[model samples]
Target: MSESRDRRAQFGWAFYDWANSAFATTVVAGFFPIFFKSFWSSGHPAETSTLQLGVGSALASLVVLVLAPLLGAVADRSRRKKPWLALATGLSVAATAGLFFVGEGQWLFALTLFVIASAAFFLAMVFYDSLIVDVATPADYDRVSALGYGLGYLGGGLLLAVNVAMTLWPEMFGLADRAAAVRWSFLSVAVWWALFALPVFLWVKEERDADTPSAGQAMREGVSELRRTARRIFDEKPVLTFLIAYWLYIDGVHTIIRMAVDFGLNLGFGETSLITALLLVQFIGFPAAVTFGWLASRWDTKKAIYLGLAVYAAVTAWGYFLAYEWQFYVMAMVIGLVQGGVQSLSRSYFARLIPEGRAGEYFGIYNMMGKFAAVIGPLLVGVTAAATGSARLSILSVLILFVAGGWLLTRVDARAAPSPE
Candidate 1:
C-alpha cells in the first residue's frame, strides 16, 4: 500500500476520473439538456419532455444497477479491470463525439446517445472505484479517494469552461453557428476524454486475471455470487445500516444532477448560464473536495459527510427562495463544496467496510442499491413538479431524503469496518 501511494501507476489510475469527467460535465450536465429540449423537443408539451428525460435516466440507472456489479465482480476475479475500463471509456467517448450528428428535432437520437454515454460512464466507474481498494492501503484511502475526486473536478471544470467559452463565442472556434459551437463542445469532450485516459493504461498495471471463464459462464455465476454476497452482508448490522443510509442519500444526490438542468430550464435560465453554472460547480468542487478530503482524515469521515448533507439541505431550502440568476451562483457554490466530498468519501468509507476477496461481488449489489434508489428521486421530483406547478417548491422535496439519510448515517459503526490487508 505504501508503495502504491504516490506511484505513477496509482496516480494514473485516479486520473481516469479526470479523463472521463469531460464528458460528464460538458455532455451530461452542461449543453446536452439544451440539445434535448431545443433539438429533441417535438412540441410534446412540458410534461412529456420531462418524462422523456426521466424515463431515460430511469433506464440508464436500471442498466447501471445490473451491469456495474457484474463488471466489478468479473474484473476483480479475472484480475483484468483495465480492458473493461478501456472499453467503457471508448464507448462513452464515441457516444459523446457522435452527438455532433444529432441535430434539431432529434430528441430520440439525443436520448439514445445519452443512454449510451451515461451507461458507459457509470459502468466505467464501478471498475475504476474497485481499483481503489486494490491500489490504496486503508489508511491512504482517504487521500487517494480525495485526489481522484479533486482531479475529476479540476478536469471536468476545465473542459466545461472551454465548452462554455465556445458556446458563448462561436466565431473563435471558426464556427458560425452557435449550435455548431455546442456540437464542437461534444467533440472536445470526446478528444479530452480519449487523450487524458491513455495515461492509466500506459502506467497502471492491472491485477492478475481472475480466471478464464466463458462470458456466459461468468454471467451465470456472477448473478449467483451477487445474491450470496447480498445475503451474507445483510445479516451484518453495520453493513446493512450503511447500505440503507447510502441508498437514501445517494438517491437525493443523483436526483439533483438529473433534475438541475430541467429545473433551471423551467426557471428560464438560458442554456449558456445553466451550463456555465454547472461548470462552476465542477471548479468549485475541485478545491472544496480537497479541503473536505483532508478534513475527513482529521475528523470523522461520516461526520464530514453529515455536514455535507446539511449543506445540501440548506441549499435545497435556499433554492426555494432564489428568484434571480444571482442566487443560482451562490447556490452553485454551496453545491460545489459538498457534492464531490460527500460522494468521494462515501465511496471510500464504504470500500473500508467490504471484505477484500469479494469486493467485486459486494460492490455490485452496492451499485444496485445506489441505482435503484435513483429511480425514486427523479420520479418524485417530476410528480411533485407536475402536481404543484412550482419548480422552486420542487427543489425543496429533495431535502427530506438528505436529512433522513444523514440521521441514518449516524447508525453506521465506523470502527467495525474492515481494514486493508
Candidate 2:
C-alpha cells in the first residue's frame, strides 16, 4: 500500500473507535445505569438495583468471554474480520436502539437489551483490534493504537455532550422530559455508531491469507486452532504472564468504568454531577491517550503501563474514602489521565508479542481475558455490596486487583517478544 492509502486505512480503522465509543460513553458509562435505576428499576432499592446492574454486566461479559476466541479463530481462518465486525456492529446498534422502546418498570427488558448490545459491542472489538495490523506497520503499533483510543474519547465525548445537553434541557431538544431525552440518547448512540462505522468497512481492508477455508471448514478448523492457541499461550511465559496481569488489572479498570456512576449514586451524588464527571473523563482522555502513546515511545511500554496501574491503585484507594462530589470529580480527572493510556498501551504491547497473521486469534484471547476479568470484578462488587451493605467497602474490593496485576506484570519481560520492523 502507498503511504497515503496506509494513512487512510489507519484513520478509517481508528474511526470505528470513534463510531462505537458513543455506545461506551452515552450508554455504558453514562445514562444507562441512571436510567436503569430511576426509570426501569424504579421501585427497587438502591442496593438491589446495583446488584442487578452488576449481574447484567457480568452476564454480558460472560457471553463475550465464551464467544470471543471462537469467533476470532473463525474470522482468521475465513478471512472475514470486517464482515464479522459489521455483523456485530449491526446487532449492537439494533439492540441499543431497542432500549428506547422499553417501557418504564421493565428492568428485565432493559437489562436484556443491554446484555445483547454489550456482548455484541465487545465481540466487535475482537475483530476491530485485530485489524490494527492491516492499517499500520508493527513499529507504529503504539502510535496507531493510541490514535484509535484518542479518537474514541473525542468522538464519544462530543456525542455525549450533546446527549447530556438534551437531558439537562429537554425542551430545547423537543423532548417530553429527562426520561424521554435519555431514551432519545440511546437512539442517538445507535445512529452515531452505525453512521461512523461506515468508514472502516469502506477503507480498512483486511489482508487475505493464503488457503482461506470455507465457513464450515473454518468452524471445524477454528475449534482445533483455538485448542492449539490455548496450549501455545500457556507455553509462552511472557504471553501468559502479561495476560494474567492484564486480566487482573484491566478487571479493576473495567469495573471502575462500569460502576462509577452507580457508586456515585450510592454515595448520594446527584445524577447531573456524576454525568458531568464522566464527561470530564472523556475530554481529558483524548489528549491524555495521545500523550501516553508518546510517553511509551520515550519510556518502556511496561513502565508506562505500570505508571497507569499505580495511579489506578491510588484512585481505587481514594474512592473508598470519597466523601464529597468534588472528590469524585477529582478522581475522575485523575482516572482520565491514565485510563486510555493503560488500555491503549496494553493492546499495542500485546500486539507486539503475538505472531503475525494470527492477530484475530491472539487478540481474541486478549479480549477473553479482559472479559473474564470483568466478570469477576463486577461480581465482587455486587457480592460485597449485598453482603456488607456498604458501597465504600465494596469499592475497595477493586484495589486488590490493581495491586496484584501490577505485581504480576513485573514478571513479564518486555524483550521476550518484539515485533518485526
Candidate 3:
C-alpha cells in the first residue's frame, strides 16, 4: 500500500467505530434499558426487569465467548477478516432494526432481539480490532486505536443527541409519543450503522499472506490454531497476566455501562435525567479519548490506564451513596474522562504484546476475555440486586474488580516482546 492509501485505510478502518457505536450509544447504553423496563416489561417489578436485562446481556456475551476465538482463527487462516466482519455487522444491523417492530408488553421478544444484536455487535469487534495491524505499523498503534475510539465517541454522541431530541419532543419529529420516538431511534441506529459501515468494507484492505488456506482446510487448521494460541497465552506470563487483569477490571466497566441507567431508575431518578447523563459521557469522551492516546505516548500507557482505573474505583464507591440527580451527572462527567481512555489504551497496549501475523487469533482471545468478563459483571449485579433487594448495595460489587485488576496489572511487563511460537 502507498502512504496515502495507508492513511485512507486507517481512516476507513477507524470510521467503523464511528458507525457501530451508534448502536452502543443509542440502543445498548441509552434507550434500551429505559424502554425495556418502562415499555416492554411495564408491569414487572424493578428487580425482575433488572435481572432479565442482566441475563440477556450475559447470554449475548456467552454466545460471543464461545464463538469469537474459533471464528477469529478461521478468519486468520482463511485470510478473510473483512468478510467475517461484514457478516457480523449485517446481522447486528438486522437485529437492531428488528427492535423497532417489537410491540408493547413484549419484553421477551425485545430481549431476544437485543441479545442477537449485542452478540453480533461484539463479534464484529473481534475482526475490527484485529485489522489494526493492517492499517498501521506498531509505532502508530496507540494513536490509530485511539483515533478510532475518539471517532466512535463523536459519531455515537452525535446520533444519540439527535435521538434524545426526538424523544424529548416527539411532536417536533412527527412521532405520536415518546415511545414511538424511542422505537424510531432504534431504526435510526440500524440505518446509521449500515450506512457508515460501508466505508470500511470499501476502503480498508485486509492483508493476506501466500499461505492462506482453502475453506475446508482453514476450518480444520483453525481449530488446531486455537489450541496453539491457548497454550501460547499460558506460556507467556505477561500476556496471561494482562488478560487476567483486563478480565477483572473490564468486567466492572462493562457492568457500569450496561447497568447505570437501571441503577438510577431503581433509585427513583427520572428517565430524562439518566439519558441526559449518558449523552454527557459521550461528548466528554471524544476529547478525553484522544488526549489519553497522547498521554500514553508521552507518559506511559500502563500509567495512563492506572489513572483511569483509580477514577473508576472512586466512582464505584461514590455510586453507593448517590442521592440526587446532580450527583449522577457529576459521576457521568468523571466517568467520561476515563471511560474511553481506559478502553482504547487497553487495546493498543495489548496489540503490543501479541505476535505479528496472528492478530485475528490473538484478538479473538482478547475479546473472548472481555466477553467472559461481561458475563460475570452483569450477572453479579443482577444476582446481588435480586438476592439483597438493594440497588445501592449492588453497585458496590464492582469496586473489587477495579481494585483487583489494577493490582494485577502491575505484574505485566508492557515492554516485553511477544513470546515466539
Candidate 4:
C-alpha cells in the first residue's frame, strides 16, 4: 500500500478500537463475570465464585504482563503490527467462540479463557497502542487517541447492548434459557470482533523505515533496545517522574476497569442490573472521552489528567457509601465520563517524551510497567479482600494509590510535547 500523508487516513486506524473492544465489553466486563459465577458454581456459593474468578484473572494478567514487551518489540522490528494484531485478536475471538460450549461445572473452560483469552487480549494491546505513534502526529495524537478510546467505548457498548437484548429476551434470539443466552453473548463478541477487525489489516500500512527484519535480528535488537530504553527512562527525571505517577494512578484506573463488574455483583446487584449499568457506562463513556480530549487540547494535559483523577476519587468515595443498585448505575455514569479521557491523555503524554525510532520498544516497556502495575493492583485487591473479608476496605487501597500518583504527576513537567521528526 502507498503511504498517505493525510491525518484522516488515520481514521481507519481508530476503527481498530471499534473492532476489538466488543470482547472487552461482552466477554470481559458485561457478561463473563456473571456467567462464570452461574456456570462455575459446582453448587458452591457466590463468594467462592468471586474468589475463583479473581484468581483466574490475576493469573491471566500475570502472563501478559511478563511477555507483552518482548512480543511488542519483535513485532515492531518486523515492521508489521498487523500480523501480531491478527494473531492476538484471533486467539481472543476463538476463546470467545469457545465460551459457547462452556456450561455448569465447566471450571476448566473458564480457566482456558483466563489463560489464552487474557494473554492474547493484553498482548495484542501492546501492538495496537504502538500504532498510536505510527498513525498520528503529536498535534493530532491527543484527539486521535481519544477518538480511538471513545469509539472503543461506543463499539464495546453497542455489542453489550446487543448481548443484553439477547440475554434478557433470549426467546427472541432462539436460545433455550437465560444462561444459554449469556453463553450466546460470548458468541456475539467473537463475531463482532472478527467482522470489524479487518480494516486495519486492509488499510493501515506498516512502515518500519527499512527492510523488515527476521526473527533472529528482531530478537537481537529487541533485547538491546529494551536495555537502552530502560536506561533512558530512568535517567531522564521528567520521564521517570511522569511514569511513576502514571504507574501508580493507572493502577487504580485499571483495577477499577478489571474489577467493576465483580464489585457490583458482590454488592448484591442482580445480573441484569449489573450488565445494564455497565452497558450504560460504555455508551456514556464514548462522548465523554472525546470531550475530555478536546478540553485537554486547550488546557494543560496534566491539569486535564488531574481533573479526571479528581472525578474518579469522588466516584469511588460515593461508591463506598452506596446502599442500592441505583448507586452503581450513577457511579458507572461518572466513571464513563472520565475514564477514557484520563487514559488517552496519559498515553499521549507518554508518547510526547518517547523518541520516534524507539516507539515500539519504549511503548513495550510502557506496556510492561503498565501491566506490571495492573498485576499488582488486582493481586492487592484480592489479597486485601480475602484478609479483611471486606471489598469496601479493599476499595480504599485505591485511594492511596491515586493520591500518591497525583502528587508525583504534579512534579513531572510536560515540557516536551514534540512531534517525531
List model 1 lDDT by residue over 318-375, tens digit each: 7778777887777777788899999889888888888766666666667778767756
Better of 1 and 4 by lDDT: 1
Candidate 3, residues 97-173: lDDT per residue as tens digits? 99999999999999999999999999999999999988888778878888899999999999999999999899999
Tens digits of per-residue lDDT for model 4 on 108-190? 77667756887788888888888877677788778888888999999998888887888778899898888888887778788
Task: Tell me the whole-model lDDT of each prediction, alpha carbons only.
Answer: 0.80, 0.90, 0.90, 0.78
Worst-scoring 10-residue span by lDDT in model 2: 412-421
The 10-residue segment with the lowest total lDDT in model 1: 1-10
For model 3, the superposed segments whose C-alpha errors exceed 4 Å read: 40-55, 105-108, 256-263, 374-397
Q: Model 1, residue 163: what's the lDDT?
A: 81
**Residue 165's lDDT in candidate 1:** 86
TM values, all candidates: 0.88, 0.91, 0.91, 0.88
User: How well does model 4 score by local distance difference test?
Assistant: 0.78
Residues 72-191, candidate 2: write the lDDT tens digits. 998888899999999999999999999999999999999999999999999999999999988988678888899899999999999999999998899998989999999999999999
CA lDDT of 294 in candidate 1? 92
Q: Please identify which of the two predictions, 2 or 4, would achieve the higher lDDT against the true structure.
A: 2
Alpha-carbon shift of residue 257 in model 4 (angstroms): 5.1
